[model samples]
Structure formats: C-alpha cells, structure tokens
Target: MSSRGTDVEDAVDSEVAAPARGTGTRRRVGYVAGLFGLLLLLLLGAVVVLVAQGSIAIPIGEVLRVLTGQDAQSQLSRTIVLDARLPKVVAGLLAGAALAVGGAQMQTLFRNPLADPFVLGVSSGAILGASIVILGTSGVGWLSGLGLVSQLGVTGAAVAGAAGVLLIALGIARRVGDPVVVLVVGVMLGYLAGAVVDMLVYYTDPDRLQALATFTRGSVRNVTWNELQVIAVSCAVVLVLSVFLAQPLNALLLGDRYAGSLGVNVRRVHFLSLASVAVLSGITTAYCGAIAFVGLAAPHLARGLLRTADHRVVLPASALIGAVIVLVAEYVAGGNGLTKTSLPLNSVTAFVGAPVILWVLLSGRARRQAG
Candidate 1:
C-alpha cells in the first residue's frame, strides 16, 4: 500500500521476469540446435548408407574407411566407394543444398511460397542452354564423355540461360509489381524454354538425344570427378555468398520500401540474390540434370520444422533438409540396388514434393478464409 513497499515489489517482479525470459530464450536456442544436430546426423547417415548400398554392396566399414582416408580391404571396394558411389553421393549433397538455398531465396525474393528454380523456369533455362550446346555440337556423346573444356562450355551455357531467364522474370516482375503476375510470367518462360528444347530434340540425331534425355530425367550417377569439380566450386561459392545475403533477404521480406527505409539497397539485394540463385540452379542442373522439387519442398519443410521465416535459420536448415531429401530419394530410386532399372530423381522427389505443395495450398486457403 505504501509507495516504498510497492516500488520494492515492482523491482522484484522485474528481476523475476527478466530471468524467465532469458531461460525461455535459452530453451528455444537449444531446441533449434538440437534439431540441426539431428539433421546433420541424418545427413551423415544417409551419405554412408547410399555409398555403401549400391549394386556392389560395399560394407559400411569399407565405406567409412574409404571416406576417412583409411585403406579398404580390397582395391575393388576402394574403387567402388570412391570412383563410383562417392561422387554421386557428394553430388546429391551439393545439388540438394544449392537447390534448397536457391529455392529459399526465390521464395523470399518473390514473396511466393511456391517459387523455386524448377517452377519458375530457371531450371528450364539451364536445360535449354545446355540442350542448345548439346544439340548443336557435332558428335557429342554423353556429358561425362565430353572433354573438360567442352564440359565447361556447356556449364557456361547453362549459367547464361539461367541468368537470362532470371533477368527477364525480374524485369517483368518490377514492371508489373505483382507477385502473381511474376509467377505466371515465370511459368510461361519455362514453357517457352521447354518447347524450344523439345524442338531441338525432335530435330537432333537419335544418338545425340540420349545425352539430352538424361538432362530432363534427373540423375547424379553420371557426374564424374571432373564435373564434380565444377559443381563443387560454383555451388560452394554461391552458397557462401547466400550466407552474407541472409540479412538483406530478411529485410526484403518486410517489403522493398521498408527495406530501403532500413538502408537496404533493394536493387542490389535483388541483383545479388537473383544472380546467386541463377548460378546455383544452373550449375546443379548442368551436372545433375533438371532435378525437381527439392528446392520447392526443402524450404517449406525447413520453415515448418523451424517455425520461422528468418533467412538466417531457414537458409541453412533448408540446405540440410534438401540434402537429406535428395540422398533418401536417390536411395529409393535405385541406389538401394533393389531394381535393375533406376527411377528418375524427379519421380522420387515428386512423392515428397507433391504432398508439401498440397499442404501449402490448403494451409494458405485456410488462413485466408479465417482472416
């Protein structure tokens, strides 16, 4: 009742509330860290299992030995683990991470939950670029057979194609100033690119078409160490750059005007993000073929699990989730050695992605109705 007594009581309550808030913050951080650790373990497990369980069935011990620089029991085991399965597994990791990060960036940049490289024509652009090179070149065999110079040329073409589509889409998006319109434009661009690729395939030699066919049906098996070098360097660089862009991306989520008010160079952020996505999507498509859905699904899954759209968390979480999805899909597709014929990576990814797409649509609809 007295002023002094009341003041003392208020100070005591403030101290108690501060400690409670700190504890809650610590608990949340721990929960997130635990989830990340579990994801990492799953990734490591998937890698080992995939590398070990191919047609030859290398033992897990030998797989670890080869991975850890120890000698395998047999030279054949070493070759199978290293020269065969390891590349594919590594490619899966890199491609998944790249696509997922690209997808997360696309979703933020466009402010559309469904935006992704595959959906938005970036992957198709890369495919068209590579198809032109593959269809135009004389006596070209499979991608792996191409010399390093030729391979680089094709990869370069893919990057250019991705960039071309991205620039066009961004320009149209700027002019229209509508996310829905941008989405439609992107889909149309994808269709146009696909039509051109189809025409090229129709006119090309049947034998040459085999190389192009692999581009549509995603598979990492063909990625050689040589090709891996390109995928590794480009994806690594772009992925690292994405880390730096996370804050700017989060700012963009609040809207360009607000982001600009906050001193974010909206145009520069857009350029860098678009460029990074182009590079990531293009390089992954070049090596692994037009893998689908990992990008689209991974970001959604990451956000759902992490329960946050903060790019700092979503970006890395999406990478790990995407890698795990690819590895699991690869195993199911034929890496398990259960079937003589392997399913396309896209086929497997569809099983995972389709449900997520539906869930997103339904959840969004529910939110709108409730609002």
Candidate 2:
C-alpha cells in the first residue's frame, strides 16, 4: 500500500478498535438516572406506608390531608394528624436520611463498609452526655428554671461528646491507616463510653435516671415542635455541608495517597468527614438515642443495589434507602399489624442490620484494610 493509504487504514482500525468516550459517559448517566428514580420511588413509598400505619390509625386520606395541610374531620383528629403524627413522621424521615448519608461518608473515610456514624463511639458519647444532663439535672429545679439556652446546653454537650469521639477516632485512623484497626479502636471507644454512662447512671439520682434512660434506647415519640426546631436547624446545616463533601469523599475512595496526588488534601478531607459525621451522628443520637446499624448497613445496601462505590452515587442512594428502612422499621416497631405494644426502634433495626454485620464479617469486607 502507499504510505498515505497505510496511514488512513491505521486510523480506521484505531477508531474501530475502541468506542468513543461519549458512549461510556452516556451509559453512566443512564445508570445514575435509574438509581435516582428508584430512590425517589422508595422514598415516596416509605412516606405513604409510615403515615398510614401509626398508632391512631389515620386513614390514608387523613394522612394525605394532614401532609397537605387540609382540614381533618374533627379537632382532635386534626391535632393528632397535623401536630403529633406529622412531626414524628418528618423527624423519622430526616433522622433516617441524615444517618444514612453520614454512614456512607464514614464507610468511605474509614474504608470499612461496616463503619457507621455510631461505630466510633460518637453515638454512645452523645448518649452519655444526654444521660448526664437528663438524669443528673432534670429532676432538680434545673430543667424548669433553665431557659432555652440552658436546655440547648445539654444538647450541645451531646454534640460535643459525639464530636470528641469522632476527633479521637479519626486521629487513630490517620495515625494507623488501617480500617480494621480503626474499627476496633472505635468499638473500644464505644465500650468505654458505655461504661462511663453506666457508672454515671449508678451514681445518678433515681428520679432523673428514669427520664435519662430513654436517651439510650431511642424513641421518636418525644418529638415536639420545639425540639424539632433545634433538629431542623442542625440537620439543615449538616446536610448542606454533606452535599459539598461528596466530591472530596469520592476522591478519598481512590485512597489517601491517590487522593493527595490529585491535589486533594487528605487531612482536610478527614477533618471535614469526621466533623460531618460528628454533627450527623450527634444530632440524630441526641434525639433518637443510639439507634443502631442503620448507618452501617444502609450504605452497603445502597452500594450493592446501585453496584457502584462512588460517593456521588452512594451518598444520596444511601440516604433514600435509609429513609425507607427507618420508616418501615417505625411501622414494625409501632405495632402496626403485628402486635399491640410498639417495639423499640433499636429492636426493629437490629433485625435488619444484624445480617449485614454477618455479611461484612463472613464476606471479609469488614476485615479488609482500606489501604
């Protein structure tokens, strides 16, 4: 062949050998779209099912009415649906979403699919902080005498406690650089926090103890509009922070060394990730009381379902999945269809999360290091 003809043939062969980059980009976009669509459907379904199944048994019509701000048939009914049930549902939805998103970040940061917002003993620390406030102070003139500022002090303490554990755990993770080692470190921290809580409870006055114990078991029933406001402000702030965090977290998934090579500050990512986890876990634990395993399992489920480890995909997917799991859990825990007495939120979650724990361990994912 002539030289010009040979060059032309080689160019044709190269074009035929590999597809255009645009095709791969289009495929990724489609996959993301499908996962997002699934997430939306699951979120909507969860809202409907949970709203329909609460204790007072509001019909789906009334539930919709309340949600839409339409009048109910009776004043008591209106109050129940609008004021009581609505807040509980909203709280559950936010709590679930926040925990799941936080969990996803934690898993990526620690490089352990099993790592959750709670795993670093942050939740336990919050529980301890809240317990001290509730059990040691509520019975005194303290709660009655204190203004909203003082009341927030307790919640603030819970947040600080959670943040403290997160700082410590992240420090260890940075120093150690092994996911399993960090996981063990987190477990020990949690146990230590629990032991401290136990000692405090033993020393605490009996009247205060009763009120404080609820902080450990988790409950959605105590949510009033006042407390909701605090949760609202905090959740809003943290969630926005989370949205900005997605890209950095995704970079980290490539490993600290690779992320650093890409001009991503590994230390800064760790700092932000831990801070986000602290706020996310702290606020949820403060209100919900150490709800277990939602964080640990939801991200795994989201990743497995979407078949992608990218935080940009997994973060939002996990949030949607988390909301669904908790809403379903709330119905199960709330004595819908199965029994009269409502089961604890922790109990229902354990049933869902326990198997995930087993899988992480048995599948060797839990034992693997991020490095």
The TM-scores of all predictions, comma-separated, are 0.97, 0.89
In candidate 1, what are the lDDT values of residues 1-371, reduced to their tens digit?
A: 69999999999999999999999999989999999999999999999999999778888988899999997799999998889888999999999999999999999888888889988899999999988988777645558567778788888899999999988888887798887788899999999999999888888888788888877899998788888998999999999999999999999999999999999999999989999999998899888999998999999999999989999999999999999999999999999997899999999999999999899999999999999
TM-score quality measure for candidate 1: 0.97
Cα displacement (Å) at residue 225, model 2: 1.3
Q: Whole-model Cα lDDT per candidate?
A: 0.91, 0.77
Lowest summed lDDT window (length 10), candidate 1: 137-146
Candidate 1 global lDDT: 0.91
Judge candidate 1 at residue 237 and give its lDDT: 95
In the range 1-371, model 2's lDDT, one tens digit per residue, is 69999999999987875676667778878988988898788777767666666556767777777678787766776777667765766777788888888888888887886788677677887777766666656554323434577668777778888888888888898799888899899899999989988898788777666556555767676677776787878887887788888888888888888989889988887887778777777777776677888888888898888788877778878888888888778877872645667777888898989998898787774456542
Off by over 4 Å in 2: 2-28, 139-147, 335-338, 365-371
